[model samples]
Target: MTVVTSDILMDKELLHKKELANSQAALLNVLDDQKKDSEKILKKKAVDEAILASIGDGLVVVDKEGKITYVNQSFEKMLGWSSKEVLGKRIVAVVPREDEKGEEVPFNERILNKVLRGEVVVTDLTNPFYYIRKDKTRFPSSSIVTSIVLDGEIIGVVETFRDITKEKEIDKAKTEFVSLASHQLRTPLSTINWYTEMLLTGDVGKLNAEQEKYLNEVYRGNQRMVGLVNALLSVSRMDLGTFIFEPEPTDIPLLVRSVLDEQMPHIIQKGITVFPTFGTNIPLIQVDPKLLRMVVQNLLSNAIKYTPEKGKIDLSLTLTDEKKCLLFTISDTGYGIPKNQQHKIFQKLFRADNVREKDTEGTGLGLYIAKAIIDNSGGKIWFESPVSNYIEGEENVGTTFYVELPCKLLEKSK
Candidate 1:
């Protein structure tokens, strides 16, 4: 009986040991599968990163020693240096310092200190930072440097730059073209303007009624051409960043009156009646009076030109609390601009189809210039036109242009 009990205990112990061994084998298999999955995920991430680094724009990565650790194909091609030559080398060896005289200066402690202190240096206007090539030849580059940090600790910096010699040449060519074109146009325009004024003033000779009419038409056409040329010059100056603004304290009412006075002859000749309502207590605004005068003149001229004979033009100035701005509106009983074509009215070289059909002589730059002047002066412009208006026995539709300028002086008023 004692031998039989000992045999049963031995069997139970063996069985328990076998079950424990089977459980350990299962756990090992799971761990092995997990490790394989983690390695696959890691490999996928690395491939994605590699693809990103291979883009067209230059990309560089540096280590804590400010040595190039990773460089893409574009970066290598841009600087004409191989990754093998640049790896583990100090960045200063690649991008050298430039002195005030644009000479290559020796790289020293100052540059490294500033970079390590976390200064992100950027330069776009100037060109040709130094770039050392594999052949030991230095070339010009346009570059930007930004520091790389990890966990509040300075690690390294990455620089991406390009060669801009071609871009500079293109810009220089554009400037020369603008200069030459403006000069060519202005010379003949000035002569035509002077000679036309001489004829109009009878400085050359007197004339009969018909001759006077023909001469007057010639004078008007020349004047219009001069205006177009002036607009072109103004746009060119704006493009070149050389537009000058000379501002002063000016009475708004007086400026409007002066513009009306200049347009008096046109108003009378067209048989258009002017109804101007001035504000009694309007404040003087600080502005470029010449620009403001041009704005008013353009609006009034358009009104008279578009309106038929014996039509009416209404000019008004009002100050409202809602709009603490100097508001001027010029309403005319003229041919109304079509709703579809109104949006294009302020575009350069864009004339309304109706206007073009009636009058082909305009340069279509008047509203564009007026809009630009008002915008530069910190103002807004808009227009309102009725679909139809009741006339003597029918509808006489027209449009109204509204201009609103800031009451206070802009910081760049002068």
Candidate 2:
């Protein structure tokens, strides 16, 4: 120990000091990078705020627990609540939103909760609710809520909404105008049809061959005009929420038969084979006859129009196995819908390319009108059409439309 080298001890001390300096330098570099990251985060936040402020619709962001995390300027202006007041509060605490039934929903039952659970609610014009402002004044709002998914997990929700009172008023006025105009147009059209039919049938006097041909064309034109007028009127009523829904006891099988009879001429012309399967012991349920007739007529007419000669149509009215709903399926061996275009089948004025070329007379409003009527009656309508549904050698063999309605129309759950 007494002979230890003093020079070696001094060299060791220098090496240790150099190692400490290097460590300090690395730590300072990390601090500088962290500061730069902080600035970038602040800039990003500013950009987000600017974008959110520019939106015309009210926007709100809520965390998983439904706590209000962020809101845009329009949201503040619309609800009369600043972000500061709502940031930590549950969104339901500030809004006091009610369902269509006018009952205030609990926090867990609210649509916000549903969104967090991965249910997308997109612009429910049919089932909207009242949103109370900070001043306790309420207004009708149409809203859409979507989940904020991150890494395949629903972490929060974002809701966007707009006040629809003005829009509703405009729709009502438009509906009235359409109703009035349709009624006015129908009277003259009916007179024209009556006279044309009289000329054709010799009710007034016998007509020459050429005269009868011209009169027949006029009669057909008038009939088409009448159908357009009626469709317009029905669309107007649906838009205005003014459909007179008087539920009367109905015989569904009898109603179906009458509609099929109306299409018999077309069926015979096309050489289509039809099979009817009525459920045994079918019960009579109260439903709006005119509205349901429109549905059946639309489906049957479409089947007859699209199917080729020697095709088959299978019509059924059955009680679902659960016995809780009525299932009406109309399956037709026609040109099946294109896979890419099936989604647009129910849209207003939409026609598929394949069918449009074959039958140019379609107004494209049949399915749209039928969907609206069924939805109003608290039912569902959908279709399955694929090339695979046809025979092995056949392409675009057929399509099937299913209308499932509850035995008793249940009140809307909004």
Candidate 3:
């Protein structure tokens, strides 16, 4: 009986061991399937990321600790660093810094601190800081830094940068061209004005009536030529980024009235009736007086030049919205601009064909210069005219040019 019991016990133990082996094989198969699925997902993610990293613009990803977790191919190519050199390194090791004298300091200064504080920095990095290239050389760049936040927590930063050396070179060339051209044009213009004045004053010698009349014509032509040259110079200065605005607190109503006074002679000569109106107690505006004067002069000049003899021009200035802005309107009974031509009216050297045919003496630069002045002064200009052809007794159906300027532009000047 004892021998039989021992054999039975041994058989039961063998069966238990086989059952355990089968259970272990099932678990292994399940784990293998899970591993394959994870690997497939990881591969897909890597491909998507690689495509993004291959773009031309630089890209970087940092962890909450400001240590670089991932960097793109473009970023590596831009900064002369490899993945092994930059991964797990602090962002300060890669960002450029500048010294007190506006020179690159060539030291690692942390940028993530400022970014994590929720500041969006956009700057022309080419001016003071540059990216070190793979060849151990530096290149000019412009970059923007924006904070990355998740669930109200600062996670990291994203920086985009590009080389701008060529852009800077082009800007420099443009400035040089404007400076040289302005000098060349102004010199001849000054000489012309001086000589014309001398002749008109009879300082050189006395002249007969015929000679005097011819000299007067020459003087007038030269004056117009000088105005054109000056307008061109101002436009060039603006294009080259040399135009300066020195704003001062000025009375808007007074300025408009002064412009009207200066234009009175022409308004009378044209036989056009004039109506000037001012709103009660208009506030002063902060503006470059000279530039604002030009804007008003240009608008009035256009009104006078376009209006028919015996027509009317109305000028009005008013403070609106509780002294928030100064509104100016100059309406005219003129040969109204065609609807199609109105859009092109402010383009440089663009003249309405109808106006050119009627009055062949316009420079076509007045409106262009006026638009530029208004834009620089933080003002806006627009005009309204009828789309249909004009009929007799409908003289008021002409163009009305409106300008709106902010009062803050005046308050800040104070």
Candidate 4:
């Protein structure tokens, strides 16, 4: 019964052969699929590399330790360094950055380093810095940095920069033109102002009420024009690095009081309640009195001009808890700056939509000039608007501007 049979053996052999053939076909299919996938991945990688290399702006990639990992063709051309030479080198050291005054930026303060340390950095084109090339020459560069995050961890950073020499030259030319034009217009403005004043005061001849009123209007308009020209001159000087600082030991509290006294007439006109708080033990700060006064006048003017009748304004002068710095604050219950437009508040000639709609007299240069003065004085200027209160229809739909300056005398920039 268990005897071997030819037909049975033949059938078993055929079945084994069939299975072996099927196994080989399946293995070939798997190899084919892997080959296609590898080809696709290689093609995609090449495309990505080509795209990065073809970018017009200089681009570089650095690892977590800040070593150069990759650089595109534009980087090589703009920086005068080859990709082979820069790979594995420190990016900040390879390309040193300089401030407007030509001082080297500190290592820790580099934007790439800040990004590596997990800080969110934002830079604008207006704040251009210089980047050194391999030949030791530098060019004005505007750059943007972004951290390379993978799986919730920052593994690297990417920086792209462009040369802005033409832009810088254009800006300088524009400022020079403004300076020349403003100087030329001053004589005519002065003549107009003097004659109008004479007419109003009856130095030439007695005028009727209507004539006097018309002359007064002309005088006010001319005065506004003169103020604008002065503001423009100030901006041009600041931009051209010709603004001089004359620091003195100034009684800050007394200065603040004088500003308030000058503004009291306008305050009374508006029926605005003023709460002036002069903190005790505040020390006199050594600063440029004229520049500081201009800053105060701009802030207080905006507060009084923007606040509605019967609104509240708070003016405070105090020393920080450390007593090392002086803090000047002016807050008004006026129209708050729109949230979306707050970032551009200090930009030149940039008026917020809300303010422009409510008040048309703003030259949009006050905050710009104020910021420049404070920055040159080695102080900080910033503002905060209670937008929520404005949105909720509270009485304090307003903004608070703060200026903090060190108590000691700061060396004037050359």
Candidate 5:
């Protein structure tokens, strides 16, 4: 009995030793796996840091409350602000934004704040704004702000921007060159215009019918050239921030009526039926009469020119419900702007493919100029194509342009 008990105890000891060895081996394997995971995490963090440091555009990240969290190296270098100085500060208070007129953007209107409030804000190059730097100097910048979402919730916002100082310089140079060339060309163009006018009026001896007809054609062509030169001059002035605005209490309805009268011949020639709906008690607003006249003329003429024979045009001028601004709307049964190319319609020297194919006479600067004028005058201009219902049929879809202007003159800055 004693010998049997001793053999069982010896076997139990051997089994206990084997179980301890297996446990130790499993522990070592788990430690090895943890070490590999730590190494991988560190390497990935380094790579991400390197990429953030190497980006050429300035980038900033802020929490949902608009507190600065991370600013890339480019942000520090471009804004002359060190990350240490700006970390944890309110983004809007650290950096100021200004419109083209040098008016400070209101705090509540800041894009960061809007993003925090759950509004999606996207800006393009067309709306370039100035960002003030640490030293109180400023540069024009183009930026995009996007919300950083996690688990279907917005946790923060990220903004990426780049300095467009060089772009502004290049654009100014181009405008200056255009202004000089236009000024130089005006002298010869004026001389040709005066002579052509005198010949057509028989101040010089009149020849046969053929000669008179040829001279009339020359006069009309010269007039068109003069018109183009004037448009270019106006654009150059606006771009260089030298355009002068002389605002006076102008009758909006009368202005529209005069423009319509001037364009009546062409409208009648095209057989386009006109419907003018001038709202009652439309107040006289403070605006530049000549500039306003030009705006109306461009819109009316474009509506008439693009519409086909027997097509319809509806023009309405009314005060908003608040009665603080005027709304001018013009819609036409014409070749609507193509869907894909609608975004480029207001660009300088850009014409839609449909328009270019239909009419070769346009300089493609009409809408561009009209927008520039309205924007400078504290008015807003926009358009909708294929006018609303968008029925696809034999008749081409049309476009509607809307312009809204404040009642009082706006203080503008250079």
Candidate 6:
């Protein structure tokens, strides 16, 4: 009933061997494919590492939990902390942040959290912060932090920053040089102004109508130079690291009137009306007389320059509701700043197109210096203006500049 055959057995054995061989071939193919994929991944990782290492600015990478995962060589050198030392530690562990006033930035209000929370972040050159290095030395740094997003979720964060010590030093040096040069230049400029005044008033000698007109022109030009030098010196002084502060209990309305008196010539020439208002029962406040004078002069000068002939310029100084601060506002009825260009008006050397066309003699430094003075004095400044005020000749929309100074000093620059 069961007679086994050798040929049948041989055929069965060959078929089984062939099936096993096919399975082995498929498995080998899969293994080879996996090997290629691994090689690609390693190559990409190497490339990323190379790029981060070669960058000039410091680069730091952190995992979702905010632990430092990697740091480039530049980062190690700039921060004075080795990659091995920083890795696995909190990203902020190597350095702490501070504001311009040396006040510690609260951890909850940090760029790290903002990026990790998947919020849009933008950093500007002007908004620099202080970072303390591993050596315990502090330096200013400008940084931009971004998140590594994956699947609509934040997986990690990357920060790029650079030390601005050299830049700061260079800026300081330039400021000093400007201050020195302005001082040197003022001597001769003052001599010229004094002599011109003498000649005009006949203190030295009398003159005819023609001679008086020419002398007046010369005196005006000399006065302009003196003004320019004074402005330059003020800017340099503000830029100096150790500023000389002399805050005293002062009368603000009296100070404003003095500045207005000095600008009376320009006011008369333009035939513009000047309105001055002081809050009833305004109290004497402690302030830097020189610096506040600079701010008032700048605002009033700009108001007069931008306002058309016979335009109205209103200046007001009042106490806030809390009586904690003094508010000064200068409103002009001339050419107003465009809404689009208003944001950039205070930037250094930035001039709006409309204003630049109207006045070629403008240095674009007036507002910049004005803002610097107010900021360093622990005050805030802002402006509101319509784009096009030109309805007819002698009547255009205008700009209003506002400044709020603390009654007592804040922890602003000294």
Task: Put down candidate 6 lDDT per residue, 344-410, tens digits, no spaces.
Answer: 7887667877777788877777888888878877899999886643233423688889999896643
TM-score per prediction, in order, is 0.54, 0.81, 0.57, 0.91, 0.88, 0.81
In the range 188-259, model 4's lDDT, one tens digit per residue, is 999999999888888999999998888888999999999999999998998889999998778888998999
lDDT of 1 by residue, 9-39 (tens): 9999999999899888888899999999999
| lDDT of residue 169 for candidate 3 | 76
Descending-TM-score candidate ranking:
4, 5, 2, 6, 3, 1
Estimate, for each residue in 1-414, the C-alpha lDDT of model 5 and write its tens digit.
699999999899988988989998999999999999998999998899789879999999999888899999999998999999999998888998998889999867888778877885654466589999999999999987888889988899989999999999999999999999999989999999999888877897867899988888888888888898998899899888899989877888999999999999998898999999999977667788999899899898888888889999999998888776789999998988876666677888888777676789898888888998898788999998853332344336778999999865422210
Candidate 4 residue spans exceeding 4 A from truth: 1-10, 388-396, 410-414
Which regions of candidate 5 fall more than 4 Å away from where they truly are?
1-20, 111-122, 207-217, 339-344, 386-395, 408-414
User: Candidate 2's C-alpha lDDT?
Assistant: 0.85
The best candidate in terms of TM-score: 4
TM-score, cand. 5 vs. native = 0.88
Clashes of each: 1, 0, 1, 0, 0, 1
lDDT of each: 0.74, 0.85, 0.77, 0.88, 0.86, 0.83
Tell me the lDDT of model 5 at 156. Answer: 90
- Which lDDT tens digits does candidate 3 get at residues 214-254? 98898888888778778777766765567889888888888
Instruction: Please provide, for model 2 over 1-414, each residue's C-alpha lDDT reduced to its tens digit, 9 standing for 90 to 100.
Output: 343677788788999999999999999999999999999999998998899888999999999988898899999999999989999798888889886557787877778897787764444354568899999887789887888888999999988988987977786797799899999999999999887877788988889999988888888888989999998888878766677887677788999999999999989998999999999877776778888999999999999888899899999999888777989999998888877677678876789878887888788888989998888777999999875322344454789999988975422210
lDDT of 3 at 129: 55
State model 5's lDDT.
Answer: 0.86
